[model samples]
Target: MGVVVSLEDSKNRQASVKPLVDLTKGDMERVNQLILSKAGSDVQMIPEVANHLISSGGKRLRPMLTLASAAMFGYAGDSHIKLATSVEFMHTATLLHDDVVDESDLRRGKSTARTIWGNQASVLVGDFLLGQAFRMMVDVGSLDALDVLSTAASVIAEGEVLQLSVAKNMETTEDDYLQVIRAKTAALFAAAAEVGPIIAGASRAERNALKSYGMNLGLAFQLVDDVLDYGGSAAELGKNVGDDFREGKITLPVILSYRRGTPDERQFWRTAIEGGENGDENLEKALALITRYNGLGDTIARAQHYGTIARDALAPMPASALKSALLEVIDFCIERLN
Candidate 1:
């Protein structure tokens, strides 16, 4: 069984996200329109597969970061909408590719694009989305923003490749895992937050601050996700529990448990993980071992560490509703582990 959060903690998480959602509602409506407009193609399969995932109930958090970050600096222009749309496209594109790579059946509790449309269609449509995202970035006409997002795209690719290299390898280090998440996940987040301030014409200091905030928050978000794989319900995760373990993906909890465990436990990890012998019985064992070795708790601790850094990143900025919401987002990310 996965770790369950208390009702109070769950409510707190909802409260943190609700404000950000409310604040960005109007901008997100515009972004949703742009996403729909840009996702269209004459090719029937392209739109079919693209919309399958795009219209799925993702919170659109990355793009919301773009909108809210710009709103924080009092941006009144339409470019933030374009940039936010681009961010969503980029995120959606990555999900398509990730589903194919992970061979996942479900995403957000719906059939994965690759599962419905086949891997080739999913990959091709993902490429189309990336092209559209780049075009929108060009339309935004800010070289700095373009450079940041474009670099993030490249880094995300590199992160996926790195994850491939480390997959099913029990020898993978915590540093190696962090590098993968930083590139694969945090890079886009940093770009999303940074572009908002960039388009708003905020100071370099402010831009860097949001970037730091996003980066650390991304790290914390991913760490909690790792913990959730062992501790959260399917409803909460939108995928099966122990999905990471079943996939043999080396996450922080697995890394910590594998390292801290006894020699016999290490061998057990090798058998289940590297040996690809994961079954329900083995998954139960894996969860027990994780708990015995304090893997989940320690991973949450690490997330909290990053969450603190994320909070401090915003300290110099003046207080506002947006800033408070952003800070609460950090707390929500960590509190999911409860």
Candidate 2:
């Protein structure tokens, strides 16, 4: 393990965004087109829901990672695009289902599928997308690809279940939180990055390096996201600032702040975490306590620690523009806050 770096250690810069942009040139347009084209059906309802969500516009970070990983290994084939599209479909399906499960009102600054199409339609369509993604994998014709993606899908479901199980449980430890994140957030990222090497026929060591890079990067990304839920404005994050607390979802910073709170402060957390009375009031108190205890700073340090690990994973690969872009991706994970 390395000493974690604080947010105050460096100012945010544009250099961090360079790598992701470089590796994912034209990916947004291509990904959306692929998603819409593949979601084709005679039934208008499936296409309508699929097109709505697919075109809603996310950062396309998952597919970018797949392409970036392949580029890093000097892979020149077009097959990475198919694989990347498959990964994006899987990720989108998860989000659609997640909003339904979480009863969320907003996602990516717009109405969620569940909100528009109803939970039944959203859930079934999500399942359809999952099967569509697998159909893509079959087209790619690689058992290695299938193995990594299939395992990742299983882990993602498990992670969702783990988080649901721990909800409203104030006794949840940091280790338990990390486990959920590894499964829910990082699993898809790791699979997306690793699929490149499998498709490119890279050696095991190279494959592992890409996997590590994605895992660490994904962890850093999600840790920052959790922090932003409390620290960022709704406009900046494009979602409710206190939505996590309101939903009784205990994240790392809130859990850490609670652990370090006085008896009275702990009582406040117990109410908030357990969905007791004065929910909004308790959210305010919890936010204030987190700030008082430097929970935000601690959270940033943890994200930076994983960002460093993501960078380390790139060391064994041959130097290229893709390599530089990979480093930038780690920095982007940290810099996005600013």
For candidate 1, write residues 5-28 as lDDT tens digits.
Answer: 342343423536777888999989
Which candidate achieves the best TM-score against the true structure? Answer: 1
Tens-digit lDDT track of model 2 for 4-107: 22344445455466557655787546766787788888877888887778877667888988887776667787778788889998998999899988999888
TM-score of each: 0.97, 0.94
| Candidate 2, backbone clash total | 1
| Ten-residue region with minimum lDDT total, candidate 1 | 5-14
Task: Give the Å error, residue 96, model 1.
Answer: 0.4
Query: Would you list the C-alpha lDDT of every candidate in the order shown?
Result: 0.90, 0.83
Stretches > 4 Å off in candidate 1:
5-15
Point out the worst 10-residue segment of candidate 2 by lDDT: 1-10
Clashing pairs in 2: 19-325
